[model samples]
Target: MCNEVWLTSPNSNTYAQENDDHDAKSRVFCTKEDCEETFGMFLVKETMYLPERSYSELIRSSDTIRNARFKSVNWLITAHKRMNLWAATVFLAVNYLDRFISIARCRDWKSWMFDLLSVACLSIASKFNETNGHSLHDFQVDFVDTCFAPTLIQSMELTVLKTLAWRINSITPFSYIHILAQSVDDLTKRATELLLCVVLDHEFLEFKQCVVAMSAVRCALDQCVIKTSTKNVTFGHLETFIPQDQKDGMIECRRIMAKVIARDREILIRGKKSPATALKVDLYDFRNFSADDDSFLRTPEINVGSGKKRKREEE
Candidate 1:
């Protein structure tokens, strides 16, 4: 075929484009049949990428770490929305950030370190989710006071990749949503939005990605967007995809998702500001402090013109 063919890989939910020669350098894609046959394997394999501890557990010991985690998540979310990238990108970026934080145990981490790490995670995520994503510098240009050089960002990216053993093909809630969507009608749009809402809140971190996906689907079904005669049957089939131990959490998660959806509705009716608005920070206010903060590094230079930036010694 001379034209472009867009195909969804069965192993993952992300799309891949194949040119006429079937070589557009896209992610390796499998057909729908492959997804169905190996869907069970995906469920079993998702646990490998999940964080050992929930977000709450990871930050329980330090208030500073808690604040940094919250702020980093918001920054990632804001950047994703600003860039108009896929929701999965931000979710994956946060997943990478959380996993790194959990394993690295960087209790002495500074705000600027989180900023740079967030950039690196987002850069990696954009590549995962977008076919024609922004450049590395494009991601750094929006940082507070410092623009990280390409090499610095690449170094951080490599650190993250190695930390996770190069397992960047994470199975997020979106992945399960993409898979389960095959069984039901119209599960993509609303379910995905609900999943995005859930991702923004750290509470969902405790639940498995499959559970979260099911909860999002149940929530979407409740929204009455999709008409189905065997809703319970559909749910039963979806339930089978989750592990036995996670089933209980799925019920509780669905309840929490209900509250979240209701709260979202109330915000719309009351015309209140979004939670995202509250999460926005005064980048300028912290710029000076972060610029001088050597906690994360000797410090990358402020220049964005070159690949390599000079590292200034601690004064």
Candidate 2:
């Protein structure tokens, strides 16, 4: 307990590392009992998570998006890349928006709601996680052709806030991302991209977030090998980081994600869908409101499946 500010305040951020504070240089770690108790509390809290969609419900949509959730994931990933933001913040934003849609059972996946929801959720996510918050102008410019009035954006934010009961800090796959990953490099960035994809897929709902991140890490490292790994990362190098119990799940996720990536790559090679050729979810019975408003930005005819090959923009 030398020159250390003890875990003194109840209002202190539990999320911060004790060692991050210069004052805690010689502070003793809380004993095993404390660690176990904290972990157990986390496990109990995890049980409260709402599993929004089942495998059948996800695949059996009335619309013909053979992979409805998959497309949404792709959309989110592309938007994130175009914005040049942290992958995790984008993940957190999409997590909030997707979970809200699933929980609300808003079958209107094709509605204007989601477009607005995307803007609001990303702004909120940036506020929570980023040092600098995203502005309406930032969203408007980055999402060209999809322009919303500032008032409309604010209203939608309030609606999403209420719908989610203002729980913006809900647990996400990214929380455990650091545990499975060693370093943030090209391989890890690709892994995060894969992680974002799987998290949005209802097909992978059975697996936990940790399993998804671990699988992504495995898949990304494998891609690096094929693509000429700049970091020389290998699956075996990170194997010890994964828990023994999760190895099986990680393998299954790796297989599934690889297949997904392969399919996306095929699409990219063929060129992305033109705005006129965009596909909708199977259940596109009647649009309460067109999500395809002139205000909404449709997927551009760029290389959609470009994957990690798309060079990161200089920050």
Candidate 3:
């Protein structure tokens, strides 16, 4: 029964060919004024199609490309502070929550609602964390102002808290290790520090670049130690640190770091990756005390108007 229906369906080649021919003739007839006027009177139908130009052309244009580069540089210099930080925080929190809910459970109306609720909670938490004076009620008011109902806002806040906790738990181990290595006096620590200092000074702003430098360093150290007969178990006595192999991994790491830093700095200075921008308004309130300025004194003022005037004009 299904086979028979499939064979005689409108999707059949004969029916499709006839429909295509009819569509072509109608399109051709519509292009003519008399036929369009006659067709328009008979059929009061709306056209569904709209014309579109390719975005690739705009992206490829020199001015557009230059502007995009400038925008990227501006973002790096300002650390994306010109845009609403709250909006960005909310978006990031919501997106992460949505991903977590989608991955842990099936996508449905219930899941979507749960994700939204989670995002709101996390946003509130972040606001509270960032601004010590802000209360939960303040967050609630802000949420409502954004057009969310009280019930939805409350639910979202709960979900966001849970989602954030889960994400933190997953990355806690790696985060701890990364933090620990920074404070340690080991060779790995030194290598990592050099890598970080180089990369952080540049506009790349990615941990993966640091990882690549670390990997290259490790590989070079391993190759250098392979030639030596004595097995130095302690990191301090490693051959890479003492004699230093010309083809050592640490050398390669330093080279890579230098190259990345040099390239990124050039890009940044050229306004291709780090454009000049104003400091964040929120950061303006922060004050720094200088010990050197403690002994500085204000000189006594001599008022010109209060001084005795010469009697030359009267004479």
Candidate 4:
């Protein structure tokens, strides 16, 4: 019941200047390979497993995937747009979906189940990531599926929350993507989209987020097919930024991602048909939106809890 800064707060004290300064200093000589190695070390404990729920049906093997597709990507991205969520939030939600399925051992998934999970994952991820996220009611407005009631979605959100073990503060490729994108600011958007696509498949889960991001950039560059070399900067130019030891892995990452892209190509095409270009989502919709009275869906804020408050609290 104490005063807390909502995660929605851009000025949340959780992100103090000290952390930023430390991160800035740490990345001075941090190559993508170093980032990948570091992430890979910790990724063993938690991360999205492969055969991504978005296109799980299409993938038969690491390299072999059917030409079919799923809207799990498009629907979630559209929801991301509609909810005015952070790009990272969408990725985290997808990661959550994959992880939840892996941990819960829930197979024999129904088609509509994917849609329901999409909504539930969106709500849960947004709540943890953005402080105040959309309610079941708000999501239904955009999704327009009445079969799964708001309460039902709320229940599913709890199930997802439990399945994730309340560890929603996941480390994603975006953690390193922002820093790497700085070197190639012009291609951030395109690179980020490619990163999203690659992560949708479980195949890339074995690799660290940093690796996926690097390979994604390669894939993005391949698609763009940029040839000009200003400052010797062409597509996949960042490959040099990786450590020599990890170079082969990076090369292979790019290769596997290529197949992931090929399999999801048609799905990606279909996903584009959604109203991705719609107007900006009005976040105020959730200002008073709640699934029920005293719902966990309505978190107070993204407070930087005092270290004294808990054994692991960073404050």
Candidate 5:
């Protein structure tokens, strides 16, 4: 008779012990579990990670709040590219920003405050997701004339952590992309990029993270130049994630994503520059923060990635 045994590390008090035990128990160690029950489990588990406010609710806020969010997100993207941080870092940062704002309800926030909050969010996310240490100086990139003190940034970060109740293990769309895409490397890769772009668009908040992820996978499936094997996973297999009653919502989500992608592609085709690349000629005013203090005025010392610098020199 053969016996099945679960193996655990001798140092079970380590951080990975719980994950190892959970994986052993759930039998979800593989990233590409296509079982219907596994999908159902994921769907249920993802609900807890959703933001308090939906996209519709967020958009219903005053113009000041909406514009602040949009600008802060753009700055985060710029900072992400400038610092060469991980995609997961920026995704988690945005998740924190959304959840914090929904709960904090800071409608009277100024532009510079939003900028500070954005920096704080990215800093918190980088610490959580990256092995490399990032200082507040690294986050000060892309600012025109305003620089936040480390203390201020740290304070805002603490506020976010408290508001989120220290729930830093964010389950973003990236979490489900591989499993829902059936673990195909090509499809997973493309879907991941699409989801990254989708997260930038606030419209995606209308749908659940699972739905957005599934939609990105479908979009990637359509864009696949090579036909993937469907013996194990097919379109019908993905459809099972969405019930007939909820199919319309999925379709709408996909539609929003298509428009988002189309606009993204057009921007690339037109060679439009992102905010980070645009020339900064005008000095940012600090009148909102203080009319007398000049201490906030500091030059931005942004570093260009080696690849980008080399490409630019070649051009």
Candidate 6:
């Protein structure tokens, strides 16, 4: 399956044109009926292993990560140039790691840890450069009573340092902080994040679909944000343009930010958007060959051992 579905070079116009006829033929006939039947049988065999939910519900549930308000606040700070990209990336990485680990170990989601990690990583990275010179002790004191114990706090600090080292070694020093800051809408922000993720790690093939989907969503958000922000339109004032029925759709746009991230991961791993089937054939022809001539033609073979061979020769 991997060999059959490996990533190929982006399609060229010539290849697309060549496939146009084949695509039309596929649409006109059940070219893959056997493959489809086999897949259906396999699916039936694996029905017990399948998760019980509509794809939409699974997608929506994945979007719950966007409800994470700390991301919004972090965006705000990074937008202002108050935080460096390295700091921002490290902050986010540390926060995500802590959350993932905590969830796995404790089965609890600590939302506040995100805020604390953002602030702490930013402070530490700033101080390391001797530019900001912020007091680390103050940060420790502020979060002391929170979920972080002294030992856990030390571990978090070490984790931040290790992550920073890994990032610095792996990624170029060019900062994406400005691009992210200028993204005035959630879609734009999400798209920027996905793009940055890909840029930071090209091996993250799972993000390709999310990045494409977010690109569309971000463009929509860009239009809305520009209109609203530039025109100074408030929620109350938006009633003039936004209808009540459409309001739900507009709100759902934000949800797409989360959904794209979640759905992209799931799709890349488990789901197949379309069938993995194609018409395959091999052509064969029997032809006469004359040693003295370059051209060949189809002809019945004469068995030299049989009397019919002499008869045909005489004929």
Q: State, as a TM-score between 0 and 1, how close model 1 is to the true structure.
A: 0.71
lDDT of 5 at 243: 53
lDDT of 3 by residue, 1-315 (tens): 101111112224534543443343234232234343423321221111100122223323434332332332232223322323332233233233323332223212222233234434344525432332332233332222133344444444433333333221111111111222222234333333333234223222112222333442443344333422223312222222222332254455555666664565454232233334311112221134232332111112211122222122110
Better of 1 and 4 by lDDT: 1
Worst 10-residue stretch by lDDT in candidate 1? 1-10
**Residue 243 in candidate 3 has what lDDT?**
21
> Which run of 10 residues does model 6 get worst, by summed lDDT?
306-315
lDDT of model 6 at residue 291? Answer: 25
What are the per-residue Cα lDDT tens digits for candidate 6 across 1-315? 111111222235534543442233123222244323322332232222111223223324443333332252333233213333333344334333332222222122244444444444444434332334434343333232332333333434444433222221111111222222233454344444444323222122222222223343443345344554434312232123333543454345445544545655432221233111111111222122122221111112211112110111110
In model 3, the clashing pairs are 73-273, 117-156, 118-159, 118-160, 121-157, 220-249
Instruction: Compute the lDDT of residue 7 as modeled in candidate 1.
Output: 21
lDDT of 3: 0.30
Listing every candidate in turn, what is its Cα RMSD in Å to the true structure after a full C-alpha superposition?
Answer: 9.9, 12.9, 29.7, 9.9, 12.9, 27.6
What TM-score does prediction 6 earn?
A: 0.28
Candidate 4 local lDDT, residue 76: 68
- Tens-place lDDT digits, model 2, residues 153-198: 6656655555554445544565444433444466556666666545
TM-score of each: 0.71, 0.60, 0.25, 0.58, 0.73, 0.28
For TM-score, the strongest prediction is: 5
Q: Candidate 5 on 262-313: residue-level lDDT in tens? A: 9886432212444442212135555464423423322121111111111111
| Model 3 poorest ten-residue lDDT run | 43-52
The lowest-lDDT stretch of 10 consecutive residues in candidate 4 is 306-315
Q: Clashing residue pairs, candidate 4?
A: 5-302, 6-301, 6-302, 7-302, 50-202, 51-202, 52-202, 307-315
Q: Least lDDT summed over 10 consecutive residues: which range in candidate 5?
A: 306-315
How far residue 16's Cα lies from its native spot in candidate 2, in Å, is 12
Mark the regions of model 6 whose C-alpha exceeds 4 Å error after superposition. Answer: 1-120, 124-130, 137-155, 163-165, 168-255, 258-315
Alpha carbon lDDT of each predicted model: 0.62, 0.51, 0.30, 0.53, 0.63, 0.31
Model 5 has an lDDT value of: 0.63
